[model samples]
Structures are given as structure tokens and as C-alpha cells.
Target: MGNFAKGYSMKDRQFWVIVMSLGGASVFVFAAMYSVQPLLPFFTEQFQISVSYASLSMSMTTLSIIIGLMVLGFLSDRYGRLPFVRFSILLTIIPFLLMPLTDSFAVIIFLRFIQGFAIAGVPAAALAYISEEIHPQSMGLATALYISCNALGGTIGRLMMGYLTENKSWEIAFLCLAFFGSIIFILVWLTLPKSRNFTIHRRFIREDLYGFWLHLKNPYLLLLFGFGIILQLSFTGMWSFIPYYLVEPPFLLSLKMISFIFLAYGLGIIGSPIANALANKVGIAKIRTIGVLLLVGGILCTVSTSLALIVVGLCIACLGFFTTHSLTSATVSRTASHQKGLASSLYLVSYYIGVAAGSTLLSPIWLHFKWHGIVIITVLLPIIYLFFLNYTLHKKMP
Candidate 1:
């Protein structure tokens, strides 16, 4: 058993091991989850489906992840965190391997759904693991680093799949992803230390349900949960349709060229830790609000016809989204006094629901209004939610 009497800090060798291992776990989780996003357009052309229908390749996965987070998170709370983390990565590899053997789109979607549920194990348990194992002073930075890895995984996954699909075949892409997942799994299994701080809860099912209900009843947590939905809804909605938008526009681009746009996600890698550092100086709430404003502004920028402006807008949007997401995620861990695992799970449930909603719900807007309509709705929703967030926070303050 690892030492749990004292939390690991930046100065300790074990701290880097834990953070890097968990961070790699996060990378694989997200990489597997979002790998198909760039392929939405390709799926549409190949399968002879509509844009919205093709999006099921993405949404179905997120939808399953929502369910998996609840189950895996609850289980992890009772069992242990490390097991779920390892289980998630191992499960993630199966779908990728099987996806290449079948030509049926429905089969692929079913496999993606299963893959998504498998991917949830890591996220369902990871934040709570960090909260318990890492030193309080280092928690924010640790969480930020983990979240940044989320962006890195997503960017890498999309770019890899996109490029491979354009040059080779989507089947080839899935095979490569499977090979990559294997490497990540080995590293995490070997390097991730056992949780010393985890206190196994052998509670009744009824008691766990009640714990979930209690978190739902907390008004502040509800606000944070709501924020998670809005942030991802806007962010995902923008990225989901951007490929279609670029493929058709006056400035037509190939899948290979469009894949490069995911580099914008790199800004997310930078934004998360920077947001954490700034929050330390100012305040989390204030910085979070600034992050939202940046998101709103960045979305509006994409409305422009200029390609340069659109690319710039994407970078800004990624930065803003990650900044808000990193802070919101950390705050959720801090806010829940009990059942941190359940709270984190609930927060992610809301988060991925936004992902599902953005991928599917925004389809009509893209179908009818195109990029203009998407921009209007995505920009307006967050700005309105920002006011609501401020009002709720003020009302709660003494």
C-alpha cells in the first residue's frame, strides 16, 4: 500500500509519477472518446447520411459515457480508484480493435458506445483520486495538468484519425488508435501508484443513491453543474460542425487541411494551467467569468468570413473553454464535502450531456442556418448563462 499519512506534493518524486500516470490515463480516455469527431464528414459522405445523423458517431459515445460515469463512479467509491482507472484504459482498446473488422456503420456506432462507457472509468475516478492523494497546495496545478492532457489527447486523436482517414482508410485509423491505446495502458498500469488516501466505502445502494440526491440538492453544485453543460455545449457545438463548414465554404479545404485546425486544441493545453495560476492570484470565480467572456468573444469571431479570423477564433475559443473547464472541474472537487467521486461523476455527466447535445441538438441549426445560426445560438447561450452564474453567486455570498 502506498503511504497515505501525508499527501504527495510537487517536491516529491511520487507526485510526478501519480500526476503523469493519471494524466496519461486522461489522454487515452479523451483520445478514444473524440477520435471520431473529425470523421463525421467522412462518415456522412461514405454512409450517405445527413450531417446530424453522421454526428451519432460522436454523440452516441458521449451519451454512453454519461451512463458509465454514474455506474463506474459509484463502484469506484465503494471499491477503489486505481482499479477503475486501469479498467477504463483496458476496456477502451477493445472497441478500436473491433471497429476495423466491420463495415457496418451501425456496428461501428454500437462499438463506439461501448468504448465510451469503457472510457468513463478513468474520469469517473481520477479527480477524486487526485483530490485525495495530491497535496492541497498542489491540487489545482495537478488537476490543470490532467485536464490539459485531456485536450492533448483529443487533439492527437482527432488529428491522427483525420489524417489517416484522408490518406489511408478510417479502418486503418482505428487500428493505429488501438495500438496507441495499448501503449498508454501499459504505462498507466506500471506507473500509477495505489491510492493511499482512498477510504473504501462499503455503503448500501440506497445510501449511495441518497448521496447522489444530496449533491443534486446543493444549489451551488447545481450552478457548477449547469456551467459544465453550457461550457461544453458551446465548445462542442462549434467544433462539431466546423469541419462541415470548412469543407463547403468559399475557401474549400481537404480533410488533411482541416485536421490542422485541431492544433487550436493546443491552446487549451496552455490555457488550463495558466487559468489555475491566475486563479491563485485573483480568484477562481473572477477568472472563470473572464474565461466565459473569452469564449463568447471567440465564438463571435468565427462568424467572420476570413479564414485567418476563423482559425484565430478557434484558438481563442479553445483557450477560453479549457480555462473555464479546468477551474470548474477543480471547484466541483472542492465544493463537494462528501462523496467526491459521486460529485465529480455528476459534474461529468452534465459535461458529456452537453457534448451529446452539441453534437446532435445543434444539428438542426447547422442544417438550416449553417455556421451563422450555430454562432448565434452558441454565443447567446453562454452570455445569458454568465449573467445567471453571477447572479447566483452574488445571492449566495454573505
Candidate 2:
């Protein structure tokens, strides 16, 4: 009984530590994604560029992150998780601090790309680490906690960036992010338990590569991959443009007011873990369908300029996104048994592809359609997503 109590206590402590570490690392991702969002106006004004060029601050970071996810994901298979996670995040520190000093817009973008690349190191490995280390029965809740941290960090990063952007220079914002990243990295190294289940990465010749093809061959894998992309596109499209929509006519909401919408995302941290518990209780697939409906409904709210309605919609949307993301990520991990690391990389790759496509493609929608036009296009996305998800579900059924 004493041994049992000790084991339970140790597990509980490790659980909380991993949770804090994942959440801490996630701030780096949120900082990478949203650090530039509030600074859009500032970048355009300082660099003498258009909204399109200024938005690339977000785009370049995401684009690099995709590369990072793929490359690092692959590397984690050949090497252990910690080295890459540490190397990638620690490397980002220089570029982030440099961001404040660079005079050339081009150089700033290059630095941001490096920052994006560095941020990519954490995700796949973090998930895999938890999956391997945590008890199988606890995997769903553990993964959900990791993802919730991701959402919460992102929510806080964007909100804080916006608040700072209201009063300070864009350069200061990047520097501030560097400070946060460094502090978090330190905390993570100190707190996270050393991997007990992790083995030394064996050299991969050609046979090591087959695991990739093997996972992709599964039809369900293909469907889940596609779903990740569309989900990211929908979420990124909404977030990348929200500042524009809320700050526009009839509303003229300030950057600070727009930042407050991210407060809704705090609710996402709560929703994801809750949703995961519920999904496991009922069924992930069944619970996920409801999540899809939430995504559609939330996007619709942004269509109206009504402040209260949009706010409510954003909260709901945040909840939906976390639910879907947590479920899909867990699905990919469980489904791909042979090379979970590579499988994770692909899921992340698809996810970032959606982000890149959304951030790059939707700028034109904003330019031409304004908010309603953008909403119309985004709304079509979820409608199509529902059809495909349903089609895929039915195929599974019979």
C-alpha cells in the first residue's frame, strides 16, 4: 500500500510537470503565430509596405514552421526527442532578439523564419513523449492537456502582443517574446521528467523510410491528414483576419478590444481537456461531429459586425477548434503504430500546410470581399468539411 501510494504520488507529480512544460513550450508557438498579428499595422507603416507584405510576418513564420515540423519530425525518428526539442527552441532565441535590431524588412522576415523553424521542434516530440511515457489509459487526457497548453499559450501570446502593440514598437514585441521563450525553456528543462521509455534513435537506412509509406497507405490516415489541413485553414483564416474585421467600420474596435477576443481562447484550454474526456466517454468520432457543428456556427457569428455576437461566436469557435485538434492529433498517434514520430510529423505537416494556405490565400479575400466576403468563403470551407467528414464517417460505418 505504501509503494502504491508512492507510485501514485510520483505519477501525479510527473503529470503536472509535463503539463506545465508543454504549456510553457506552447507559448513559443503562440508567440511565433500571433507575435506578428498585432504588429501588422506597425510593420506596414515602418516598412512602407502593403497589408499583404506586412502579413508575411505571420506567413514567413508559419512557412518556416512547416519546414521545421517535417524536418524535425523526421529527425526525431533518427535522434531522440529531447535533443531536438532543446536544440530547436534554444536556437530560436538569437533570431527573436535579433528581430528588434534588424533594419531591413527582408532581414526581419528571414529572422522570423528562423524563429518559426525553431518553434517547430517541440510539437511532434512533445506529443510522442507524453504518449510513450504516460500510461495508455491516461493518454487521452494527457494529450488533451498538452494541446490545451498549446491553445492557452497562443491565446495569451496574441492577447499580450496586442496590448503591447497598442503602446510600444513592433521591435519591442519580438524582443519580449524572446525573453518569454528563454524563461519557458529554462522552466521546461528543470521540470520535465527524463524520458524512461525513449530509446536511442537507430540509424535509418532505406527500410527505416518504409514506415512513412506504411502509415500513409491507410485510408483513414489519409482522411485524418486532410481533415487536419482543412481544420487549420478554417482556424487560421479566422484568427489571421480577426483584427482586421473587428477594427473596421460600424465597429472600429481598437487593437486592445480585438485582443480581448483572445480571452475567449482561454476557454479553449478548458474545453479541449473537457472535450477529450467527453470524447473518450462517448466516442471520439461521435463527439467530433458535434465539434464540427461548433466550428461552422462560430465562423457564422463573425459574419455579423455585432460585437456581442462575434464575441460569443469566437468563444464557441475556440472550443470547437481545440476539440477537433485534440481529437485528430490523438487519432493520428493511435492509428500510426509503426512510426509514430513520422506519422506525427505528417499530421503537423498537413496542419501547417493549411496554415500557410490560409494565411497566404485569405489575404486576397480580405482585400476584395472585406469581412462578409471572407466569411462567405470560410463558411463554404466548413460546409465542405462537414460533407467530407460525413462521407468519411459513413465509409467507416458500412
Q: Using lDDT, give the best candidate's number.
A: 1
Model 2 misplaced regions, further than 4 Å: 1-10, 203-205
Residue 391 in candidate 1 has what lDDT? 92
Please, what is the TM-score per model? 0.97, 0.92
lDDT of 2 by residue, 282-395 (tens): 998777877877877898988776789998998888888778887888788788867677887888888888887677678888898877776777767866876887787788
Candidate 1's residue-wise lDDT over 127-222, tens digit each?
888888988877777888888899999999999989999999999999898898889899999999888888878899899899999999999999
RMSD of each: 1.6, 2.6
| 153: Cα error in model 1, Å | 0.6
How does each model score on lDDT?
A: 0.89, 0.76
- Residue-pair clashes per prediction, in order, are 0, 0
